[model samples]
Target chain A: MKKLPEWHRIRIIDNPVIRQALVIAGIIYLFWSMSSLDIDWVRVGKGFPRAANILAHMFPPDFSRWQLLLRGTIESVQMALAASFFGMILAIPVGICGATNLAPKPIYLAARAVIILSRTFHEIIIAIFFVKIFGFGPVAGVLTLTVASTSFISKMLAEDIENMPSGQLEAVRATGAGFFQFLNYCISPQALPRYLGVSIYRLDANIRHSTVVGIVGAGGIGQVLAASFSRYDYDFSMAILLTIMSLVFLGEFFSNWVRSQLR
Target chain B: MSIILKITDLTKTYPTGTKALEGVSFTVDKPQVVAIIGPSGAGKSTLIRCINRLVEASSGEVLLGNTDILSLNSRQLRRARRQMGMIFQEYNLVERLTVMENLLSGRLGYVGFWTSYRRKFSKKDFADAFELLERVGLSGYQNTRADALSGGERQRVGISRALMQQPDLLLVDEPTASLDPKTSRQIMRLIVELAHERGMPALVNIHDVGLAQAFCDRIIGLTAGKIVFDGSTRQITEQVLTDIYGEEDWSSTIRKIEEENEVGAE
Candidate 1:
């Protein structure tokens, strides 16, 4: 047989020794973290039966306080609706200002800062803050989800606007269309569908977050669930949980239908 | 023939330090179609875009029917732009909009923001749009989304959209660059026909010498961001092609135009 030429595959990290050292460090860190956790096997063994006992008590959900449950659920839905409506309205200008291709440097920076600040904190943390200011009601939930949804919708919308094809916009500009006219005629037609789809998705997400905000005393189904837990009313809490799950399921279905129609 | 467009020493140096055009000047006094033929990166696109101030000239004047387009403020520029229609290589239709909406968008300059937003265009604008659509051979495609059309059909829509503006000057940048040879010829024919029919001056940047010679009344050749040849179509020879596009087998390029002329004459 003829002599074969040697071949070597290129690697992402070209330095073999450094690559090996990094891999070794990763493995060691993984093991160290695992060992550092105080895993009490005896406590874990007891937790299963305790959990099973809770599950047993959770069954046969009580419908005696159905009116209270319905009111709380309705409050959550209203919070979600208000949040989605306000968030969508606020997101338009913020999203347009944030798009690097559209806005000047200062405006782009300001809009981006708003987006980053809104995104930095978790929705529950925001809900806690709003609850502090708004004094325990669905107002806090609405405000909290509004901030969350605005950030999300604005960020996604800015990205979509930045990525749009410039040809259509250029053609519109060539027609001597004013800035706002160009926006309505060309940019709107291109960005509207995606914007609406993202808004609907944010609305669905807000529905789920509405229940969580109530745990912080922001007033929703979660507040009632927390009360039921405190009172040892596990059956009622179970019913509330089921209601939340169904609300989320219905929201997902509606969002999916709307998105499909948009497409 | 009166002075329609008089470009004086137009120049464009991109931020990246590329000199796309240098002291390029031209005059189009008649309602005739002029073709700009050049190699890639020879400032053909930059030159045409400069006439409408689309690509801002570094320091120069573009006189469109006695108005110094380069000196206009943004508001004045928007008003000035209404006189010049532009066609693009990619058609540039808002793909999500229906064909009628795309066509009516040309009237965006004449209408108010809220009026255009509500899509309540004037009846005359709608009538003109329908007529332009019929002229472009896409009469019944008003309800179709722009994305659904073929390339040629989209170009037709693009042409009509520009025409809907009632522009006095037509600026075409590689209008048929994306089309096949036959479709390109058809589009070129349509553009030239429309320009003559409306008595509008047109400046077309084309790559195909044969098509340019066949349709355009005059030819302007560019090389290295400078105008090398400017005369009637019959004035272009193999030597001129060599001067514009560098040395190659000029015989075939020149022969193709001759064959086209023969076919055209017959």
Candidate 2:
């Protein structure tokens, strides 16, 4: 072969550190895969037929329970809206606490811990716990979604705060603006647009999650869907699924409108 | 005249082991434009930042009027800072905020939080902001968002904002560094003229030597974290420039002089 140029001849694999790290990662992955005991191809294959049958029965949806569907959907919308509003309101301070630039080390760490704890479990899992405490209603769904929204919104808001232009903050601080004044003049103005963007995006996600939290008896459309499914009324389940899809699409359209207004 | 600002043996060392300022000391008499000139990394930024306590001095006494600002608690420091107004090289106006809002931001130190939150400035503050905008030659641009303005216009707004504070002292760090020669001179002229109007002592850090000489009452030159030249503009000779910036070709003097003439015209 003809000689390659010096730049091309310089091999990336010549770096000993990267080569060693890749080797170690490969070895660990191989060992972990080999140590796994269960590989159930036959069970999954056997379950596919039942899934197909259920799916087939789910078609030609019956809209017999329109009143029940409407009530549950409205409840789910309320849960999502309440959770998003309260979550965003609470996130203002918590986000400031979590921002490395705004808070002291200990406060930032503690706020980060709060965010982590909130997001550690899925909203459904949180709904299960809240349902146990509050005994199954929109309250359980709202509270669960609230925690989930706060974690996501606060974390993202903190990141936006942290990433803001330091020059603007410095200029504001130099004017001798107090803590909240600095936030209002410097931090809030810059971060408001981005915060609104994130909150709207999170609201869309919360709407989807709120509809399903009812499956665990937290109270929403999912509860009705679960009941219909259990009773083998696949047609009603299909109707509920269509309604959920429509709600999601509506939520998306509303969020899009809000974003357009922000611009 | 009262000393508006007194810095005695100020020093700042960063966490990364960079000595930004070392035993720097200066004082500003009331109602004078004192310019600090130096090459990059010679503590010009650190010195100016130290004055407002934005970049805290590791060791120093920053006495503003009678209060030792370094000794003040956070609340007191904030109060003291209100009396001081700062402008930046990049104009640092909140991009999304209207020019009127940015101008009113200077009064944030005095107003209640809810006042700013509601964006309800006092009538006097609004009237003053409008007057300052007119004085700064930005009469019709109040509702314009800051990002929409040109560089010179933005700096004009910056000066208006600082003046809105009715500050006792003004600190400008490289206000003209990002601007063209003509715009730089315009900004320097505005800063100098405004400081004189308010009878507020001003400390300006600048990279351009001629602009400082043309606009400042006194020029303080720093090199390697120490003041090498502190004298009236007429007293600054080629020897002083050589001492502060080290040896460069003397032929550049004519270019600088021509640049100054062109800038002064604008």
Candidate 3:
């Protein structure tokens, strides 16, 4: 066997740059650990009785507010559906613009900037802003969810489009496929399944977010839950929490079923 | 025959300062199969791609018919590209699409976007596509997803898609590079037969010397981004092969079959 060349030999480095980075990271972790100092064993131990007392009062979920709860649940579902539908439709164009293959450099950069800005804030935060601008109710919640969903769906869709095989696109271009035709024949087919998957996932996420955005006076079950919490009605809060959990679980199940059907 | 495509002093230089094509020039008349053969990175692929403006030339003109293709706007370039069909080495079919859809993609240039979006091709285009599929021996596999097809089958689809365009010129870049020996021959024969049947000029970039010599009417040997030899198959002697490949050893590999044939005759 021939001897290996000196240039090909592996070597380990003991460098100051790596050591400095590790020291900085360790100091930051220490700072975080020091700031996490608000746990009181005695207070928690005493609070358990109060929690149990409240739980005892929450018997059978207080069906006196059944009509209100029913109305709120319906409104929440409607907000989620409207937001998801419009957001997904808008995401198609934004996602294409952000895709490196389809759009020119400037367009991709601009679309990516918009997606980043939209996703930076939580849906609840965006809902609060929209509530101030558009006034409270389902409209604000719908708008907030739409913006958040568009950001998430467009980002994922753009990534899916970017990762598609360039060979197919090149072949389509060689055939003299125009912009829309190239998208229709080459890009859409390759990215459709992934795009659908991301949209379904985003719909599930938006449903959960929509329920919470209503807590900030945007309308839905969240407003009622917040009102109950404010009145110190822990039992009512627990009931609402359970209902929200059930709704989220059902949404997840439905989303999974839809994804399977699409596949 | 009229000159269908002409290249004048074409040059392509990458951003990294590597020159892919260096003042290469050629004229391809109608109804001819011109094979470009060379070692890897010898500008054979670049030369073919430049013809269709897939890889834009840094300088010089590629005149297709009467128009200077390099000077055309995006719309005009697209219109010109519809007349030229390309086949790739990897058989770049949209894997998720059906083979029938892949063939129909060739007609996308002519069909309106809305119509193509609905996958509603005209009756004439559909009949032509089915005929081409039958010609390429993939009649029953039209509904098969491109991903599910074998390598040869995918390449067959690729060829059929090119034929679907009813193009004036066909450009094939290493069509048989990824196939086994037998399949390579079959692909070459199909390409030749299809080109002959259509009576269109076919510019094929091939790495295999035997395949090129057997299938092509004329062979243009490119080396270091320039055409070193341009002549008929009979003119591709050992000296010319040595000049193109830059090695005498390749001549031995090429001559071994002839030597065996002579021995068998004895």
Candidate 4:
């Protein structure tokens, strides 16, 4: 080579101008938002004595509400299971349709539309909407979580399918496998472990979502906790929080076990 | 020997306008083992795939047995595909599936959808699968996951899977490209012998002219998306190899011959 080009000598980190500008902008934006906020540290500080008083009253979580807590937790788990099962079943076809290599352009766009629509709203917002329609209960919780789970699972599953080796699909096609048959054999086997991995993840997410949906009067222990918080029954609220944490922990362990077995 | 597969003026032009096959036509009759030989981009794969309508011929008629396969509707094509089996250089067995499951997938066209889905294949399907496993010398490896297999073993499963279809015609695409020369010869012999035993015609797309000539009854040489030579293997000469490979060493051909003689002597 006669000489190294000037452009070749330019290192990526040579220009910190844009990076410095972004950091300055972010700092200014954060200060501006902080000024506009409703946070009052003095009020929060004053509430701590009340918090300590309630903390003292919370003496070992009341066993009187234990049966109610158990039933609520069981309902939440059932909702999670139902939503996960239906959502994952629906997601399989949607994921297949969204895969660019497998589905036609129109079908892929339609499947993507479903996923986008499902994902556009937060689970709590969807829960509120479903509660309005379904008149509040586990039904709304199930429906909301179903939409959330479908959106999450289908998008990731579609990506996994898109990444599968085309040769394996061709081999199945050469065997004369029809669309569903080919999906069942060639694509399913390839995508399954990943799907299971994602499904378990989604199940864990759905379980967590079930608890939040109850705050919107959808169902589960969250309704009781929200009520206790509103009524200033901080001890009962503490009990609910502890139960929710344990439930989440248990769900996580169960899903991890399922994922390990799948692997 | 009756006409098994008849292709007339087959052509494939990609959307990007790279013409892969230009009006290529050939016919396979009876149980003859034929190999299509050419350089890398000679459309050997395109030609083989076109027969099964896998690549979808831009313009052609492919008659498999008595039926013209190109005109078949989706449903009819699915039925028509049952009679044809394809083996790939990469083996293409679903890696997560068991070898037995891969073999049973060959009969998916015949099994009911639910039956196949539940993997509760018919007793006849199971029996035939076990028999094929034994025939392919993979009797004890049926329960083994396909991904666990070596290259040669995977191709053996690929072969058994194809045979499980009980196809009347077999399409092989560069079956030995990924194999060692010795393993290549063994795989070729397995395919040839299996074709003979099943009395089904086999069409192989191969790069090695020496291997093609050693096993195949007929050799069709393609160059740049067109057929440059089509003749019996006995009629092929070093000149034809020159026409196909385009000024590569013929010395490798001599070495291949000596290797074959040594194998024969052993």
Using lDDT, give the best candidate's number: 1
lDDT of 1 by residue, B204-231 (tens): 9999888899899999999989999999
Which residue window of length 10 is worst by lDDT in model 2 chain A?
Answer: A3-12
**Candidate 3 per-residue C-alpha lDDT over B50-142 given as tens digits, one digit per residue, 9 for 90 to 100:** 877888889988988897899999988888898999999999999999999999999988878999999989999999988988888988888
Q: List the residue pairs that clash in candidate 1.
A: none
Off by over 4 Å in 2: A1-52, B254-266
> TM-score for the second chain in candidate 2?
0.94
Docking class of 1: high
RMSD in angstroms between candidate 2 and the native structure over all alpha carbons: 4.1
Residue B199, candidate 4: how far off, in angstroms?
Answer: 3.1
**Model 3 - which docking category?**
medium
For the candidates in turn, chain A alone yields TM-scores of 0.89, 0.83, 0.82, 0.86
Question: lDDT of each prediction vs. the true structure?
Answer: 0.91, 0.88, 0.88, 0.88
User: Across residues A36-142, which tens digit of lDDT does each residue of candidate 2 receive?
Assistant: 95667789798999899988898889898899999999998888989999999989989999999999999999999999998889888899999999997889999
TM-score-best of 3 and 4: 3
Candidate structures ordered by lDDT, highest first: 1, 2, 4, 3
Q: Is the docking of candidate 2 incorrect, acceptable, medium or high quality?
A: medium
Report per-candidate DockQ: 0.81, 0.75, 0.74, 0.75
lDDT of 4 at B128: 90
Q: Give per-candidate clash totals.
A: 0, 0, 0, 0
What's the CA error at residue B58 for candidate 4, in Å? Answer: 0.4
DockQ of 1: 0.81
Worst 10 residues of 4 chain B by lDDT: B252-261
- Each model's fnat? 0.89, 0.83, 0.81, 0.87
